[model samples]
Each structure stands twice: as structure tokens, then as C-alpha cells.
Target: MKKRGSGILCHITSLPSPFGIGDFGAGAYEFADFLSEAKQSYWQILPLNPTNKRYFDSPFSSLSSCAGNTALISPQLLAAEGLLTQMEVEDHPHFPERRVDYPAVSRFKRQLFQRAHIRFQKGGVPEDYARFCRGNSMWLEDHALFTAISDHLGNLPLAEWPQELSNRSSEKVQLLREELWDEVEREKFLQYLFFKQWHLLKNYCNGKGIRIIGEFPMFMNYDAVDIWANPELFKVDEQKKPYLLAGSPADAFSAEGQLFNCAVYDWDGLRRNGFNWWIRRFHYLFRQYDFVRIDHFQGLTSCWEVPVGEQNGLRGNWQKVPTQEFFNTMLQHYPLFPVIAEDLGTIGADVRETMARYAIPGMKVILFGFQKEARERSYLPHLHPLNSVAYTGTHDTDTVTGWYQGAGDEERLELYRYLGRRVENGVNWELIRLALMSVAHTAVIQMQDVLGAGEESRMNRPGKAEGNWEWRIPTADLGEVASRLSEMTACYGRAQD
Candidate 1:
């Protein structure tokens, strides 16, 4: 991060695989090799938390912040370990190669994992599994029990469960643990496999001089094991229901603002406890990633606090938190924590000042640079600072090709004026070049932009409820994309080696 470098923003789910969704299998290794071939110094991925398709499939809203997506556990790796048969690995439904069918993938993988778990249990638990459980017990025990109970109760949110269960009464917990002990062990076993496979993949990338940049959401989901196990740390009443929810104030992206059904943090409680939970979170994440991108960093300074029953974020009020003290406590414990601030959207002076004081890098997106007015130039490549990470477009925005195609005449003209080129040469490549050539120390290009994908390939639309986080890359395109990206890297002096 000290030197100028480049990376690709592609979530593991977007990788091509025989299984419906990508995993820490051959596809992940191939992508690491691809990054090495492209001379890329980093590989950025969204959060790897287990997704809840029933609520929202967004990785930001996860079941457990410390848990890895067991859906991402590679069956190939399991087969290699002799836990699964080769026939089981090869035999699969004809899944869509271009996009992930999350539900279909989950159903298929769940059955396979169950078989593997059965085999592991019958044979014997490995020493590594025992060690992993002991090491991560702080959160693992609660998460495993929570997951087992949730599954046993048909996946109901903790708050909606029986009062004894929702409140985590020790007597009820012990009773359920005894009844669901096998399922609890199964959950723990899955986590062990996930981390084991992830470390192997991460080590492979590091060996090739490619570092991983992992994303972390600012807020935890209400239904997540974190809040379920530690209700007192959130804005929840005695019944564990949220009194104040989390969301953003109305902005250009959404006139009604965005309604994120997460519970607002009990800032006072966190401060009184010296932010131990967050410290432990970062401690775990730092071990897994070289650098972390803090999502919605503006919330650290101040956040829009929407009431519990609000339908939209338009009626939310601003609530200030002890941002400086929180970070100070974090730094006191882990001073060298490398972080990238996702400082997009409505930024206040306090947010910018805090980031500057800490020397943390902020994000700059090239897609937002072009405006009819010349005054809006901060996002323009030439105006971008070397301390920031520039991007062609983020996972939340449309692909460069898609944006250009959908842009109005005025926007197109403005883009042309900024880049000093017409769209005929391929707007995606043009913007990719702009990002690489920027003074920003790091540049990240979405996998979709590298392939010149259109609107259909967009990863997310901020306010949309469905049909998001499903984009996948074609396996055949990796080699060519790597070559082109390597050329750009060399030309722009962003090459790793």
C-alpha cells in the first residue's frame, strides 16, 4: 500500500466454478494466478460472511461477522481430503455459468457438506478442527449454537423465537444444546473447513505477491449472531427488539434514502466497554486480510438514526458518536491496523478531518467524476490524490460500459471532455486507463469493467431488493483479461514485479 499498485474488485461468488457458486477451490487459485500474471499487487473482495437469502443476500448483512461463508467451502478440497468421493465432485446439475443461482447453489452444496460432515464425524475429528474450535471459541461457540438453533427452529430470527430462546436463558440454551449437539458440531465443522481452505487460498495468493483487501461493513445485521449474543451492545429494548434502526439520510442516490434493517449501536455501552467487541472483530479480520476496507466509514463520525417502524430513511435524524475515542482505543490496542475508508456519499468535514488525521486512504470513483458543472472535479482522475484508491466503478455502481451506454448526451459530452477521447474506442478500457494513470496510489477495476460488460452484468443497484450479488465471470475470459490488464499495469508503472 505504500507504493502505487492496482487490483481487481471481484467477489469469490463471481468466480467461475462447476458448482453453482464460486468457492475456495480451483477457481480461487486460478484467479490468484491470474492476478500474478496480470502483475496486480492486490485482490479486493467483498465481505465473505455467510449470506441469508431469506432476509437479504447482501454480504454486508451476514449471519455472523466472524464466520466464513460455508457456501464458499470447496467440495474439490473436501474430495482431496478424502471426505468426498470424486463422483460426488464431478456429478452436479448443469448450473448457469454466467450468474450465480444462490438458492440452487445453497441447496446443492448443503447436501454435499452434510455428507462430508457425516464422513468426518464417523472417521474422527481432526486435530486441526479441535484446535480451530479452541482458538475461535470466543465467538465460535455462540455462533455455532445460534446457527444450530436457528436451523432447528426453521431459520427464525432470534427476536421472534420463544422468549426463553430469544433471551438466551441458560437453562433453555443448555437444553437446546443437548438436543441439537450434532447440528452445533456440524456448524463448527463447517467453519473449520472454511478457514482451513481460506488460509490455503490466501497463502497461495501471498506467495504470488498478491495481497487480499477484504471489506467490512460498518453495521451488523439485527438477526446476526453478534447482536443475538450481545443484545446489550445494540439499541435493543429489554425484549431485544430494536428501538432505533440504522439507515442513511436522503441523498442524490435515493430521495427516500436507504433503509438498512440493522440495529443502531449502543455507542455509550461500546465506549464503557472500551470497544472490545470491535477490537476483537478487527483482530480477527486483520489476521485474514492484508488490508481492510471499512464500509460506510461516515457512520463512525455521525449516522442517520431512523426510528424502528420507519419505512424509509427520509425521516431519520442525525446521531453523533464518539468517533475519535473509538478509533483511539482501537489504535491503542492495534496501532498499525491498515484500513481503507469507503468515504463515498455525503461526507462531512469531521469525517474528512478524522481520515486525514489518521492518514487512512479514501476512495475515489471515476464514474462520479463527470458532471455538467466543471466545479465537481474531486472525483476526476487528474484531481485525485495519491493517498486515495481510485476506481473505474465500484460493485455498487454500473459497469463502465453500462454507465457510458446509459449516460445522457450531456454526461457523455462531459466524459469525453474529461478523458479527451470519444466512446468509440471502448469506454470501459478508456476509463480503466484513466484509473490506472491517476495519481492515486492504488486503482481498482471491477471484473465487469475489465470484460467490458453491460448493464445486465451490474453487481448491485443500491435500493434494489432482489437480483443482486449474482454476477459471475466467464471462465474462458480470464487469460485474455489478465494479459490486457498486465499490459496496462506495465504501461502505467503499477506493475507488481
Candidate 2:
């Protein structure tokens, strides 16, 4: 593992915002400045992709891995780019000022991106658009067509579509391509605009020495273009319904384990093709960011396979994975890229062994450390692997302040004992300091923990489907925390050493 540096785990949506969701505009520039001031090297975000109604609420549940979330786009940037005028963005519509009301934000932002797309289409293409489209053709064409068709599907399942269309028959697809060519072309142009703006934003962060850490979920949404296009990779029946699905076992979030209905990959088929699907996904993602964190990292070793139509993972069984082959293939192709193993919750020894063999760093969440076994046990920082990444808490876990507020006396005492101190006023900060001081190579503090905020700042609560991922931060500056964190990073030698 490389000598890790300090970073912050702030989902892009939680950055300073009044726009319901954060975007790669002024707020992003501001964050880059903060990261530079804080001497932090990384800004970790959840997946950046297009999503559906239920899942757009949680970035973890996105529709397409390749398509950028049209929602996170900044209208202000569109204006600055000559695609829109201030007259439009300022007076377009009134949106919620506090947490992200995604639906409303989506509607407003879509119209803006649409207008921007129109302007770009009518006008000649920019140099960046030419570069991005040329570079991303590996997935962009298919993804753009998928977006166009999905919207045309109008919430109808693929099975119900006309047979030719449903099967993606060559003749019908060719016809649809010709008929919907304008829409498809415009959609492709929209993605091009998104990538162009996103690249500019990324360059600003990189210039400030801020590297982004991004997450890639193992399974994608059923309505995604990937599944609709290549149902062969999944355990889907002829009708394209999933035979078996993905999820985790029962835990604090739910007595019934989560039943993520997305189909599990066909390991044999994946191997036959040399996991080309995964290769493209990783290749495209690496081109966009500094590091990729595989969510549910244990799934690569062994996944909890839930039977389709099952309400929960209660009856799911542990299924073996072609772990060695899957990872060995990726490592062969992209040996230089870094991957963080999100090894949390009921991990098996094989998972740890796999991570060690591959030199991939796993995670240690401090909030989970509140448990009896986590402290004075191997899960604690003292016993953690030097190649691991330590977090005060994660997006799904409660914020440290929220944890302290909700945990019982025994739990608090456990934390106190571990830290060798009585609980104090700023318990969250204390935990952050501990994480910074831990032996793990990388230390990441969540935005909520930095604010010492309570449950309200919590990004998601796992099992609770809706009302998660909607917690957007106010347009508050992070200057104070940035200065304080810089001092702490310097003190801990976590500054880019």
C-alpha cells in the first residue's frame, strides 16, 4: 500500500448548497480550496451516475454506472459557459433551501441541462466535448441510447415492450436508432456537456492537490441500460426478470436483510469473456478519478445471494465467488490504480485474505467501533491493518455526533474506555482526532462528523428506503474546519508526506 494521506468523506450533494444537490460549479471550486487549505488529499464521493425515482434519493442506488447524474449539474456553470443566461437560472423556479428535494431539483436541473444541450447542439461543439466524446466512446454511445430508450419506456418493464424492442432485435433497434436518432444524438450531447464541465471541475481540484475517491457498487439498478442491454451477464430469466439477486444479511438497519433486486453476475460467463464488462467499467472510472472504492467489497470474495421475488435476504445463502480470477484479471490490466476494499459488516476471513493478497486497503468505521467486540478487538484501530482506511463513520452509518446522541450509556462508556477519557462536549471531534492518529494509512472524516452534527446530517440509514440521501448541507463555508484539520494533519504527519 502507498503511504496514505488524510482526506474527507463528503458526498458531493452535501457540499455547500442551496440548490438541493451539490454540483461541479462554484461550490466545487470552494471545496477544492477548502481541501487545499485543510491539506487533505482526497474528496470521496458516492457513485456519480444517472438514477431512478426511488434510487436517485440514494446515490448508492443509481441506474447507470457510466452516465453522469444529470441532477448534480450546476446551473450557474451552464450560465457561465454561454449555454444559459443569468435571466434563466435565477428566475427558473423556486427550490427548497435546506435538504435536497431531489424531485424538484431534478425537474429544474433537467430543464437547464436540456437548454444547455440545445445550445451546444445548435452551436458548434467545443474542443473539450470533442475530446470527451472521443475518449468515452467505449460506453457513452450505448449509455446515451439506453437513457433515451428508458425514458421512452415510460416506467414500463422491458418485458412488456414490443417483442422486437424488448429483445433489442437488430432490425427494430436499427429502426428505433434511425427514428429516435435525434433524441439519441441530443442525449449523447448532454453527456458530452456533463463530462466537459465535470472535467473542468476535476482539473481545478487536482490543481489544488485534491484527489477524488469514488465508489463503485457491485450491482446496478435493474432499469439500468447495462441490464437492459446485456441481460446475459446477470442471472435473469428469459423475460429478463432476475432469478437471483444481490444484498446483505439482517443487521441494525433491518431484522429482514436487504433484498437488492439487481441480478447477480454470471461468474462463468464473466470468466469466459475475461470479465470484459468489469474491465470497461473500471477503465472508464479510473480515467475520471484518482481512486475507486469497491462498495460491498466482500461480494467479490463471497456474496449473500438472495433469491428473486424474496422480500428480504433472510433466506439468502453465502455464495462462493470467482474471487481470485475476478481481481487477478483487473490487477493485470490496471496495476497502477488504487482500490479501497469497503470491507464492513460480518466479514469472513477469506475476505481479509483476499484483500491482503491483492494489497487492497479495507475500511474501519469508528461508529461501528462503538460495539463491544470492535474495541479491544481486531477491528479496532490498534489492531487494524496498516493498509486500511479509517473513517469516523460512513454514509450509511450515523454521524459520530448522532451516534453519541443515540447510543446508550454502556455504548458511550465503551467508546470512552477505548479513548481513555470521559465523554466530552465535542465527542465527534475527539473521534476524528483518534482516526487521524490511527495507524491506518488513510484517515477520512465525514462532513457530518466535521460539523459535529446529529442525525439530521446522516446521509442514509440503510434499510429505510426513502428519506435517505436527501440530506444536503446548507451553503455553509468549511473554512474553520479546514484550518483546524490542516493543523491536525500536520501534527499527525498525515499531510501529503
Among these predicted structures, which one has the highest TM-score?
Answer: 1
Relative to the true structure, candidate 1 reaches a TM of 0.98
lDDT of candidates 1 onward, in order? 0.88, 0.78
In lDDT terms, which candidate is top? 1
TM-score of each: 0.98, 0.95
Give the distance in Å from residue 255's predicted Cα in candidate 1 to where it truly belongs: 2.2
Instruction: Please give, for residues 148-168, the per-residue lDDT of candidate 1 as tens digits.
Output: 998998998767888888877
Which residue pairs collide in model 2, if any?
none
Per-residue lDDT of model 2, residues 88-172, tens digit only:
8887566666577778877777777777777877898778677878887877777777667767777575555566765755587
Error of 1 at 381 (Å): 1.2
Model 2: residues with Cα > 4 Å off, grouped in runs: 372-376
Sliding window of 10 residues with minimal summed lDDT for model 1: 368-377
